[model samples]
Target chain A: MSDEIVELTASQAAAAVHAGELDPGELFETYRARAAADTLNAYLWVSDRTPAGPPAGEPAATSSPLGGVPLAVKDLFCTEGVPSQAGSRILEGYRPPYSATVVRRLAQAGAPLLGKTNQDEFAMGSSNENSGFGPVRNPWDETRVPGGSSGGSAAAVAAGLAPWAIGTDTGGSVRQPAALCGIVGLKPTYGACSRFGMIAFASSLDQAGPLTRDVTDAALLLRHMVGRDPRDSTSLEFPEPIELPTREDLRGIRLGVPDELVGEGGGVQDGVRRSFEQTLELARGLGATVEPCRLPHAPHALSAYYLIAPAEASANLARFDGVRYGLRVDSGADLVSMYSRTRAAGFGPEVKRRIMLGTYALSSGYYDAYYGTALRVRTKIAEDFRTAFQSFDFVVTPTSPWTAFELGAKLEDPLAMYLNDFCTVPMPLAGIPAISIPSGLSEGLPVGFQLAGPAFSENRLLAAAYALERAIGFDSSPARRRDPGGSTP
Target chain B: MLERAQVDHVARLARLELSDAEAERMAVELSKVLDHIEKIRELDLEGVPPTSHVVDVVNALRADEPTSSLPREVALRSAPEPVAGGFGVPSPGAGGE
Candidate 1:
């Protein structure tokens, strides 16, 4: 019975809590036990402190929609008194005195914090292998990676350890891993969620979002996660409260499938191609008019992102000098040497690599050639989305080029790892809203179908995603037959 | 391909210390990434203006009224070396800077 309750979607769990049929404390215990048994290394810290939820049998005291449900957060969001490492050793043993705006919002919504989930160091890598703690294994196959740097969040939800998890998507960190792990991940338009109290990676691109078991939960969680935050100047001021309308049919909706995304020479893998084609047919049956479209600048998006993101990272990461906070190597006699030594010892290899690349690109003589050109390319990419949105309500593509690969497969090859974000990076560059929902399975692994819309069109995007989610009906639960140390088929 | 000396130079500018072997490896890895991203240069972007941000709002500011701030103890909670109610660091001149 506890197992069954833990398997409910976040929306279902919230509904159960609202009805006084389930206790958040009991739910927390079940998840805590499950988290203790987690071989995936999904959680970096599990909170032993129990939260105060509505007592059993009484109606929820607040009008907040989420009732008293349990949710896990990625380590990036600062939780008061909890270690928010952002998966880097630099911030080890450091605890924030105050909570992030998003964290406070979730608590106000009546969601209990299960723990802080693992992530890539400073949310910099695609795979969780870059984490200072360790890589999070895929729940389906323990040998494989649960797509990252939100891999831990994705794995937790997929394995039924948490109903939903909050993760930040800088460059498909949410969507790519959600797709790989057979779940729902939404990267709201940039600035839709507050960035205050979240550790900085690339300030321009960083946005916190929800990774859940289904589209409805993603929608429900997002409503509470978004709003105008005075603390975050980049936060958006919406004309209407962000609401996910209960949508049924997709009649009269226009979904454009980009030709470049599915071209022969592109990155689309064989399994992902088959799943995308089937999902397209499913959309057609749901009354969505699917048409071929073009995003000509997408080919250059990954390139522009590599340069632009790193350049911003170099500046954003400068605050980690040994004096203020975090790990400080004190062997040096002076500040400069101490700064270098601390950073060298604290940051992982990938973090150092990007900082170096960014410094080189932003250097005096080379700025115009690398960072300057990348910015121009970014403008063209945004233009590409603007033109496409004029005709199509949403642009559709496979969330990732391929399903989740084995752990450490591309760790040695930095270029190969960067190529994984080929399909997902453009949305972040354009600052548009996109969601990755489970479309179908490819050789037992989940394949994500992505739908992207222009800035601030999350309502329409989520509605369309919900309609297709029902039509396709891909299972969100991990494959039991592949569970390590259990019975094999 | 980027040279080892160039990688070391960038490391110094970024305030990171890398071993000789790591610098050699970084040069090779960064060159591969650079090779992949070189395709962007093929595009003829003549007059497109750069986009520093996507939001329409610019210069958003608050009034001059002072507000409550994070307490001193809270702000210095994570400091590696806290001294006299603030963070402490080695003197700049100590390392001959």
Candidate 2:
């Protein structure tokens, strides 16, 4: 029973708990055991404390739709008394006194916390190698990366350490890792999930999302995670709760295939290209018409993102100066020296590289040329999406140019590392919702096909993904799902 | 490529104390990033406006209401150096060379 329960998706576990067929405490213990034996290093901090279970008068599992399901949170989201380091040394040993808005809501909905997962330092790196603790290995092949900054969250779900986990997407942090790890990752529209306690990466592009085993689980998690919050002035208010469309059929759904993303010079890998083309066929069989669309400005998205994200990150991360909280290095020479010394020691190489780039971009005379140009290109990218959406309900792309690369392969080359986000960055730049669902395997690894839609079109976006999910018939549980105590193959 | 002097200037503005080696390395790497993003300059932006945010945001002012806030102790809980009910920091002149 424990073995079967461990294999169940979040939705399945929730249903079993709701029906009184599975014990929530037992389920929690099962995940706890799996986490204890985890070889992937997916969790940064695992809570030893067990679930509180139902209150005095209420019956078990009657709490909420997600009641009794165990889930892991990305370390970026603040959990009271739990380490929320955002995978950087600067924030090591730091724990928020209060839970983030999303964390609070998940607890209210009765999803018990298993632990906080690993991530890129300050959610900045493409690979989890930038983590202050260590890199999270891909469960599929240990030598490969699990995609990142949410690599641990994706790896956790892939490794069955947790039923589902939460992640954040800024330039495909959530979706890219989800794709590489062979799970479903949904990045909700900008302002959909309140960012109150989630550590800031790029204020404009950062949005909390879910990395789950399947589309159904992604929708269930999103329903509970999103709502308006007065704390986040950017939070979008819905007059009514966003209802997820349950329609599985894709009849009459029009999916736009971006010509630039799929064209000959798009830099897509051979294996990923084959799987993506097969996915398009699968979509066609599901009664959706795939049309060629042009995002002429998308070629500039990677360029724009590098500037815009770092520019915003430089400002948001400025508060980390040794004065307020977290790690502080004191030189005793002066405040300036203390700040410089603290920051120099606190931030990792990738983080410093970005901060330097951002500082240069936003500095005196260069601001108008670098950041200014990037912002204008960003508008053009959004306009390109706006024009594309007028004719198509959704746009599709190969989630990344290729499958997960080796762990240390791109670490030394910053530009090559940044290119990993080439295919996924445009959606965040446009502030649209997108999901990466496993299309199929390539060279014994998984490839993800991304489905994106206009802002507030999550229901449609998810519906299309669901239809494709059913059509493609992806097995979330691969044969590589290893025992926690065993050495990684 | 960015000059080492330019890297030094940016690091000072960003308040980071880069080592001699790090500044030299940053000069080469940041130059590559800047060159890659120079693709943005290829676009004709005669009438295009810059978008600071994707969503159209207005002030989301709330009712003038007071609510219980995190206690001072709680707020100061994560501070690496805490003093009397707040984060402890060196005085302004303490780090002066």
Candidate 3:
């Protein structure tokens, strides 16, 4: 019974609850127990509250669209009384007095908080290894990463610890991990979801997205997550209501395969390339026209993103002075030393590296050469997308050049780690929407097929992905192939 | 490439203190990142305007109205040292440079 319960997706579980076939309390307990028993170090904190079964006489579905389904949130979302650490020691044990807008809305819509998942410190690294807490292991093979800074959230969904989870994508944080973990991930158009209580990383780029076992679940979760909030000035009301895609054929869709991302010299592994080519063939068979397109400036997106994101981070992170909330290391002398000591003690190597890099880039003489040039490069990248959208309804690429590598493989080289975002960074730079769905397996690992569309085109993107997902039919069950002894990291 | 002294200077500007070992390593690592970023300077962006924000939103100020705010105690709950209904800090001149 427990095994069967764990196998149901959030949609199926919600339906069962509406029909009185599954008790909400029992459903929450099953996921909570699995989360507490997680060997991947996915969950930083698990909630103990057994949800009060939907008010006395109301049907579960009528009370909330989620039907009391439980959710796993990345630690970056402030959850009122729950510890929202953002996977950093600086904010350790610092529970916010209020919940993030997204978290609050999801809870109001009947999804109970299941746990807070681990991530890279301040959402800075490409792998979960940078987390102040221990790294989150890949459930598919315990030896490799699950991709990050959304590693824990992706691992939780792929391993069935949570029905679904929310993760933030500054660059490829959501999609890269989803690809590696064999699940669906989506980065909504910029400002689609309010950023109210989410701990700031790179303000201009960070957007909260969902990591789910399937495309439909991704759509369902996103419907309730987006809205304008009074607190977040950048947030805008979604142009249209999100709908679960019912489209099964791509009869009129035009998919642009960008040479900059998929062509030779892009460092894409042979196995990944082969899988991507096969998926393109599948798209053609479904009556979709696939043409080679060029996003010329996309090749330089990583260079621009690394500078821009960190520059914003350097300013946003300045709020962590010793005088305010979070950890403080006092020098017992003066205020300046106190601030310096607290930050040095609290931040990890990656965070400090970025802060220093950003400060240098923005400093007097180098600003024009580094920071200013990066922003101009950003303009060209966005222009490339604009030109492509004139001809193609959607642009496609392999989410990452390679599948998940060993745990410590890229840890020593930050450049190699930054390269992981090569394919996914351009969309965020353009402020467009992109979704990564499992295309197939290569070398016994999952490869993601990414579909990106112009700004506010999520409905169209989701529909196209749903059709392709059915045609590709990649199995995600291998994520549960955990060894009995693998439970102890 | 950034020098060790340069890294230390940047760290001070960012309000972070790095150990000698960290500074040495940072000088090399930050240089590698900056080298990759150097490619952008080669592009002719003479007419291209910098995009600080992707979406065009200007002066997005909310209406001036007072609403309930976080109580002082609740706001200070996460502070490392709460003093006199506020966050406590070291005296400004207790220890001089």
| lDDT (tens digit, per residue) of candidate 2 on A23-115 | 888888889888877778899888786767753444456546786788899998998888888998999888888889998887778787899
Give the backbone clash total of model 3: 0
Write one digit per residue (lDDT tens) for candidate 3, span A1-489: 767887788888888888889988888998888888888899999988676665344445435789898999999999988999999999999889999999988887888789999999999987799999989988877789999999999999998889999999999999999999999999999999999999999999999999999999999999999988999999988989999998998997999999888888579999899999999999999889999998999989999999999999999999998777898898576888888999999999999989988899899899988999989999999999999999999999999999989999999999999999999999999999999999999878889999999999999999999999999998877675453235522
lDDT of 2: 0.88
User: Of the pair 2 and 3, which is ahead by lDDT?
Assistant: 3
DockQ class, candidate 1: medium
- How would you order the candidates by DockQ, starting with the best? 1, 3, 2
- Over A11-119, each residue of candidate 1 has an lDDT whose tens digit, in order, gives 8877786777887677777777777666678899987756655434434524347866778999989998889989999999878888899988887777767889999
Superposition TM-score, candidate 2 onto the true structure: 0.97
lDDT of 1 by residue, B1-97 (tens): 8988899889889989899899999999999889888888888988888888876777878667889998998898889999999889887874554
Clashing residue pairs in candidate 1, if any? none
Error of 3 at A462 (Å): 0.5
Instruction: Report, for every candidate in turn, its global Cα lDDT versus the true structure.
Output: 0.86, 0.88, 0.90
In model 2, the runs with Cα more than 4 Å from the true position are A54-60, A239-245, B94-97
The per-candidate count of clashes, in order, stands at 0, 4, 0
Q: Per-candidate DockQ versus the true complex? A: 0.77, 0.72, 0.77
Highest-scoring model, DockQ: 1
Could you tell me the TM-score of candidate 1?
0.96
